[model samples]
Target: MTEKTAETKVTEAQRAALGLAQLSEDERRRGLLSIADAIDEHHEEILEANERDVTAGEELLAAGEYSQALVDRLKLSASKLDSISEMVRSVAHQDDPLEKTLAARRLDEGLDLYKVAVPIGVVGTVFESRPDALVQIAALCLKSGNAVILKGGSEASHSNRVLYELIREATAELPDGWAQLVEAREDVDALLEMDDSIDLLMPRGSSEFVRYIQNNTSIPVLGHTEGICHVYVDEAADLEMASDVAYDAKVQYPAVCNAVETLLVHEDVAEEFLPEIAARYEQAGVELRGDDATREIVEEAEAATEDDWSTEYGDLVLSIKVVDSLEAALDHITTYGSKHTESIVTDDDERASRFMRSLDSASVFHNASTRFSDGYRFGLGAEVGISTGKIHARGPVGLEGLTTYKYHLEGDGHVVASYAGDDVKPYLHEELEAEWTPGDRSDE
Candidate 1:
């Protein structure tokens, strides 16, 4: 038998997606649970494969070809495996994303229309590093009843191959081609051309890479680009609380997209808050670069260049700026932030509310850490990626994000001619408090 090409694989996934979409919610849930169990049972094998990738990644890191952040994301441990498995189960337990009635209205006496949720058919996702993303994306796609075609970064080829094979074998009872893994770099360009076979293309990577995907693909692209997130300490903020929030936002996990990259301090609190946070960051080995005002307050800080504001370091480096007021802070973020996630710490409810409402980012937090802007933390299970676009899905693209709705209309042998003719009847368009049952009459 001949080996299947990338086009053949995606085409098979497209056909399988139709069957997967018709499955019962419980059936899809079980398939996800199966994947979770398989992960737990074969975690040792996963770690072994991951080790090979990490070893090679470390050699590349020495050569300066790969960043420490990429290697960190590529390597997986037993604890991380546990978290990955648990995330899968969490997705399995989420509310059914399919067949939910979004809106119900009576068009006429017997004609009723319903907006029902359904799968988006075949999804082709290209993500960078983070082998765990494979599990999250696959589980979310299956639970939402959509087939997926995945392409991971070359850095995690070994890890991705193992995880993909494991998930494919675990879900053997389901449609044969529900999940397809394309390992070659060339597969991505091929995927970009299959607009007719794939319904949605989600790419998670650097801004330039995402732009490249968007430009080349005729298929609709859901892009997750660089995250230049921020944290602001308001003049009205409690200095102690602000210190803790700022510290956690940047230091907790600096390699992920939600991690804070810039720190904005109100002038009123800069003298006091900067020293405290700088000390903590220093203790944690964070390299701080600041503007002239920030450098004045923290003399030990290095001068921040203009480009630092828009860069996502994805490391233990932070950029600091001193803003004279909340308005100044907002202006700075609007100008340089990636519209990903931003947090403000303040005691004034009105100010907090204003800040939250004013920012157009995917998530704006008040009195909390910017790192809290995650799908798993938000209780939507794990995210395929954090989307910065204002499109069909924004923020964390989870199970619900993987779905789109279809309009279901039910009528009783009703003819359009009856509503048209000498006396044309008007549409009621009245809202209803009812759920849709398949084949059920609207008037009954």
Candidate 2:
């Protein structure tokens, strides 16, 4: 008789995260090495699985289930594969933020207070078709001493599972169940409800998906809701610089998160700048949605709508609006932006300075493309994701984003009662910037 008993399942999200967060620096380094080892050992398997996903992805796109860009990004090549492995190695080589002592103070003669970095514990990532995100996220979480649980898109499910297998095989040398992935039903709810096992959820797909995760789960969610990035051409903007930056921001990689979705040009330079940028978009086959003012200015542009302003057109679609001044652009972004990346092109020193200081996005740029608002360009070895939420990490979540702090007080049993005494007083303090710059701030 072929009879079977009930099968049980377990989510390592919480357990892995808690374990990774509590790991010593040396253990964390070992985790990073394990990911690198996995990628190196399973290259052929990962490549084969990617090929199958590509075939299925093509059929899905043919049926209008996936986009061309998404499919293409999901295809993994040798160089990209090697890069992911190198990234894990690099992450292991970087400084361990969780080991840093952020602050220290004296409560009494023998007692001291300490603020040190600690992991946020288990991090759950829900991303789209990019298979490399699995490796990158795993590398970052391990090196930062946080465990990660990934839930990729349906189109890449097979590929994701295969990749997870590879990672697990590589890390088999580590403590049992130290590294893990979520392979539950795509029911979305089951994935979201693994909150019982997950400490945090990072959705790196569309605004809708991220919101879904945030709405359903009590777990902390990381990643931007949208990347309606903008590039403002100032009145005194250098035409060449503005054109190049705008083109690169829009056309360089139109399908990714960092690409520009909106173009704001000061009326003073609208005629000159608009024609140049519009022509580039035209050549790239990018659809242009222009405001009435922009429509009056550009003949071939289509009429814009309220929805266009708030949309994250992860394609060759861009929204164009004319602003009276730099202030207008900043205000518009503040109103409609997901607070991702915003750039101002100008030769005016005052306007540039003010724009940089005024905008409230994760990355504010001057005389550059919004594309530069990335992990690698910003010199971070790798990034888990670009986050918009204000609570934990606000911008690109690099090594520093993975860490929260813990106070380690030494000095012969320090007691708060001493500071409460008549003559004793508590220490003064200041809030630290969430910015995770890699180097020391120069005194200059």
Candidate 3:
């Protein structure tokens, strides 16, 4: 693949998106299959490039410039590559997202209006650490009929280049510039300037980074910032189930954004639950910090500061707090939570319902781990990223998230002047169970 400037890429992507949007769903599915097939055929090449990236990442990690979590996300093995391929295939199999009528209504005697789904044109995504995100984002955009401009972390440069090139080559039969990979750090600045060309910007990073993007860009921003998630153990909870859920939330995979960062325990259960869960955390090499009430129960825990409540460790480190009631837990989470994901462990259905309904986070769970707040796990095929914001898409963003709707109005010899005249014909505005199709007439 030849390198292109950000301006050129964005312009090409705009044109390509128009062409891609006109293709049949089957044609788009075929393009996704090509990408999956390419991954299967060139798995070794992708891994070799990933190995080089991992080596460089290791050197940076040893120098203390990179976190272990960052390096872990940088490396990819044979199984990871297989998963990537399967992800693309799964995207292909998703029910078609475009051109489906969302709502239809009769406007007049021979006129009807329909709300139909359409692509968001060009999406520019800036993510860190995970090169696999490049594939997931690209496959989702292709399947949803949008052109994607992917800018992954500098740490995964080599791996991203190989994967982007493979995808671009694989989908050669489709529009040429459907997927554009921008490798330079400065390219992000260029991307921000082209709000007219790029319909949306999804940036996955720190709050500061996402804020910078939002502050600088006029384009609609879908920000995926820190995941300071919480797991609250209510007084009515089962100790065993609480232990299992909290353990998996924090220990199952602590490197991702959805992993639990803070643990809230009811004062009623503090004495009994603190020692039990702390032992499991300690055995897993997790560093635990707790409030006074918790430290009184678990002697091994370090003192947790106010800052610890809002931190996203993204590691095997957890901050614990003891709350007097479910309401206290809700107040603490509201003040410190990132609005990403939170779970409440309680056997009482009323308490669980209250917890699930009251929190403003993107995902809420009852007696389940925060780790399950994922797109693929939520049956979204795959996710571009999880949006904490309330606009457009929230939680795990899949093909549906990538789409926005258009109003398709079908009228036969109809004009607004007719409705303005003194002998105006009144519109019989009514909802209809109809799909939008060309040359289809309404029941006259």
Report how far off residue 218 is in candidate 2 (Å).
Answer: 2.2
| Cα lDDT tens digits for candidate 3, 1-444 | 867799999999999999999999999999999999999999889999999999999999999999888888888998988999999999999999999989999988779999999999999999999999999999999999999999998899999999999998988889889899898999999999998899999999999999999999999999989999999999999999999999999999899999999999999988899998999999999999999989999889999998999999989999999999999999999999999999999999999999999999999999999999988899889999999999989998999999999998898999999888789888889899998998668673
lDDT rank order: 3, 1, 2
lDDT of 3 at 116: 96
lDDT of 1 by residue, 41-136 (tens): 998999999999999999999999999988888889999999999999999999999999998998887788999999999999999999999999
lDDT per residue as tens, model 2, 1-444: 642111112244445566656667787687678778778877888888999999998998999988887887788888888888888888888887785767655444544456777777767777888888887887787777776666677778777888787777766655445456555445456656666666677888778878777888887778656788999999998999999999999899887778999999999888877887788889999899999889887889999999999998878889999999777898999999988999999998898899989988888889998988777667677888899778788778888887787666546654567667788776544333323223323121
* Whole-model lDDT, model 3: 0.94
Candidate 1 residue runs with Cα over 4 Å from true position: 442-444
Better of 1 and 2 by TM-score: 1
Candidate 2 stretches with Cα past 4 Å from truth are 1-27, 37-42, 186-188, 191-197, 413-444
What is the RMSD of candidate 2? 5.4
Q: What is the lDDT of residue 11 in candidate 1?
A: 85
On lDDT, the leading prediction is 3
Each model's lDDT comes to: 0.92, 0.78, 0.94
